[model samples]
Target: MTTQTAKNKAMTERLVEWDKKHYFHPTTPLKEQQAKGPAHIFTHGKGIHVTDVYGKEFLDGVSSLWNVNVGYGRQELADAAREQMMTLAYGSSFFNNSHDVVIRLSQKLASMAPGDLNVSFFTSGGSESNESAIKIVRHYWKMKGQPERKKIIALERSYHGVTMGATSATGVPEFKNMITAIAPDFLHALPHQTECELGDSSAPGYERSIRGIIEKEGPETIAGVILEPVQGVGGIQIPPEGYLQAVRQLCDEYGILMMTDEVITGFGRTGKMFGVEHWEVVPDLMSVAKGITSGYIQLGAVMMTDRLRDELADLSDNVFFHGFTYSGHPTACAVALKNIEIIENERLVDNAKQMEQELWKGLNYLQDTHKIAAKPRAIGLMGGIELLADPDNGTTFEPSTFAAPAVVEECAKRNLILRPLIFGGLNVIAIAPPLIVDKQDIETIIATLSDSIQAFEQRVM
Candidate 1:
């Protein structure tokens, strides 16, 4: 090899060694990583593609953890971060203090948020956002002299975050099982039970639905209901028509707060500024992250209705007593502001909506070409296809088969990156490319995934 090539190889090898020795990855198998080294050492990204340290490039099908809505390598976001850092590297939101960028971002979010969600409490990311929301609702009840209303009801198969409260609120068994001891007062109900949520006692599984649980546990003791507008980590499960509306009505009838976790579906991931807008349902509280800055910076916020904020302000005699040091970091806020401006100026939301049609066509094609592909689902750019051993009979693959991960690995071999959502006995392949992707990009991703699925079929069938 040439001298430059040799130098690059040496650097890659050294970095790999250091990573195997010291790096502790999240949501990874420690023993496997230590034994085999990292799967890919990404060095840089531009648009919807990321390049590894070994100079191999791949299309990022999952948007680097379902963020990066505006894609990667945007000079505008970089400049915004730099300018804000130069002006004010860090600013805390403590003691009721604030900064210009934070103030501006809050107002922008308020304007963009659904209904009267005009107030924002900032955090560093999704977990913090969910944690703050949980605390806020519980604290609200306490301030209202009903501290017994501390129970939070989440939906089964939902993925909130990894923080203590978020983890407890998560309905994914694997996540909650990670720790033997989790926070209390977090209950999970059957997901997407529209009739049951609407108080249809005759519906199948009604006793396990949110409404049923509230009634069984005493609605007076329930503080709020938390659910994702579009379940992300739980196999991109889209709620049936009127599902969200039914949940909102149930919460209203029971005097409980309805909170939607928009961490994944926010910022146009679902063809709208916020996913709840599709159903015209206004949640009392909403937690958002990820695309708020298109993953350029870590930032999140818990937004509340004006009425709720006013009530909390009136009820509390002391400080709220919760916030992060970087609650409203000026640099992060600046990056977010610029990132949002780019999204609006470029009309990426419209692009995502337009691309949904193309994605749907591709998903259908995959189902038609592959006998194992079934239950195709898509909303905007977020979509998933279930892999079954026998589609006609709805038979799932054995857990030990690891079918989804195997197909995803085949896609990776074809220079494409995809995520397998195997949590909760699911064998689903999630497809959520960046909003910047076009028809050609969608075609490439679908074609690659088809070949990968075929390879898996040949292996198993």
Candidate 2:
């Protein structure tokens, strides 16, 4: 056979063999998928678009699982990584020793983080970052001689991470059913469902419900209250006015540490550097990842207030015994340092702020035109369009009906990659394009999504 024929044959064989073995995808039913065969094979990515092995291009509507804030195929980020690897690729952060890049990135993060979150703890990703925060909170109270203060309050529909510890902290039920029992003492509070037709009454009612949970659990036993400033996996539930402030006050009154998981909302995904900044509510500890290195390299960080660090310092044996081998990998840190610099230099955050208005305007237009759309919520660059089976009655379709999945499939057909909210029957189309996406790309995504929703409506009807 000729060289060209040989390459094509090899590619086809690889796909068939991959289906036969080698891929066990996350968040997918193994038996069903393996029987169906291998999914789309992504060949390359560049600036908010990805091409498959067959060269069909799709707009990265969800920014490749909500990272890639600076978009794809960034040469500067690649260069930074190359330079760091050439110098020093790996280092253990176990001892008192540290590297220049790690120290520099730590200082930069401390400075940019909201409030007095001065101490930094590095992890490989969001799950580990959140896991570290949980350990720190428990350890902080133990050092303070409140060993029984171990209860943690998380919000319903909130997603912290998927580690055994962090997964327990997540309030979605689907993550809980199959897994072994998570640690006890973790309580879930009511989530803010502003998009629900129940109206303004639901906001105060939800806050009161959370307050009741805290009181019943006894404030002394509660170590911290962990929440997402804007619940990402929970259909992009944005808290209403006074909700975050009320929670802050409640935590203060009960002496509970307020932990904000900004893994998705940090580093300009929400226009603001940190989601809590939008509410002006300071958190005791914050967990961040995703855009930290613009998805060029893996890195997550936990930022805690100086007071919390000091409290831990006061105890002779209060060391946080948890970390990953790549906790502060020099290459990752160097890439992140350059990433942040690039974000600042190019004013991507401000660009996100500008594009956010246009994106929301386009989505709102869809809500007005499409009968399936119940409500649309937009905050900065993060937006969600909740689709209802009966918009007139505000009734949601059953999950088994797979309405959202159908819509998602339609979106994929239109070359738009969208993610479905794992919680609730509400069909939410989340849009958080890369901060570097220009107006033309934004328009393309909006138009494609609008067309996809229309096509979905036609089929479902």
Candidate 3:
């Protein structure tokens, strides 16, 4: 090997050693990480790809955790962050204090948000955003003298975040099982039971639907109904037509607030600027993150309707008593403003909408060519392909087989990064590349994934 190459390899080895010794990664197997070091030490990213320390580049099929809507290495966002930091290195929004950039970002988000969601409360990320939304709804009911309305009903298989309240509201068993005692009053119901949600008691899972849960627990005790417009980490399960609308109506009928977590589906990730636009359903409260700053900076916000904000304002004379130290952080807001500008100027939302057709075609091709590939689904650029041992018979592989992860590992070997959603006995391969991806990029992803699936098939089937 060349002298520089050998030196670089030595440095990478040292870095890996340091990482293994010090870094405790989130959502990773600690023992495995200590044994094998990191899977990849990413060094640089541009457009739809990220390069590792070993000089190997791979297509980021999952947008580095379903964010990075505008792709990577955008100088515009960096410039914006730098400018804001230089002007106001650190400013507190506490005690009614606010900065210019935060004000501008709040207004921008208000304009872009659905319905009358004109007020903004910023947080650092999705978990904080969700935690804030839960608090806002519960506080609203408390201020209205209905303190008993503290229960939160979320859909089964939904993933909100890791914060205490978020963890309680999250329906994914694995996430909640991480802690023994989750916050009380958080309930989960069977998801996508549209007929049951619409008051059809004859539906198969009626008793386990959101409506049934509300009825069983008494509507007056429920504070809000929170859900993702298109479930993300819960296997990218897209709801059926009329499902969101039905939930909206159900919440209205019971006078319970409806909140949608747009952490992964907001800011043009799902064709429209927001996922709720697909059904034209306007939620009472919306929590958003991820695409807000395109993974360039940490930022998130909980948006509520003007009516709700005004109600809370009129009802309480005391302070809101809730906010993060980085709430309305100037640098993060600046980065987010520029990120939104990039998405708009480049018409990436339109691109995502147009590319949905291409992604659908590719997923269908995978299903047709691979016997294990089944139940292909896509909305905008977010999609997934489920693997089953017998598609015709609806039989799944044993969980011990680790079907989806093996396929995703093959994809990684082919220099294309993808995520496998195997929680709750699923074998779903998630495909949500950056919004900046073109038709060719999608084709490359599909071809690589096809070969990867074929490799897995050859091994097991």
Q: How far in Å is the alpha carbon of 291 misplaced in model 1?
A: 0.1
Q: What does each candidate score in C-alpha RMSD? A: 0.7, 2.9, 0.7
The lDDT values for all models are 0.95, 0.84, 0.94
Runs of candidate 3 exceeding 4 Å displacement: none
Q: For candidate 2, give the lDDT of residue 205.
A: 52
Worst 10 residues of 2 by lDDT: 193-202
User: Which of candidates 1 and 2 reaches a greater TM-score?
Assistant: 1
Looking at model 2, the pairs that clash are none
Alpha-carbon lDDT of model 2 = 0.84
> Which consecutive 10 residues in model 3 have the weakest lDDT in total?
81-90
- Residues 86-135 of candidate 2 have per-residue lDDT tens digits of 99988888867688889999999998987899889999889999999998
What lDDT tens digits, residue by residue, belong to model 3 across residues 1-461? 99998999899999999999999999998999999999999999998999999889999999999999999999999899889889897789999898889899889989998789999999999999999999999999999999999999998899999999999999889998888899999999999999999999998999999999999999999999999999988888999999999999999999999999999999998899999999999999999999999999899999999999999999999988998899988899989999999999999999999999999999999999999999999999999999999999999999989999999999999999999999898999999999999999999999999999999899999
lDDT of 1 by residue, 132-209 (tens): 999999999999999999999999999999999999999899988879899999999999999998878999999899
- Stretch of 10 with least lDDT, candidate 1: 91-100
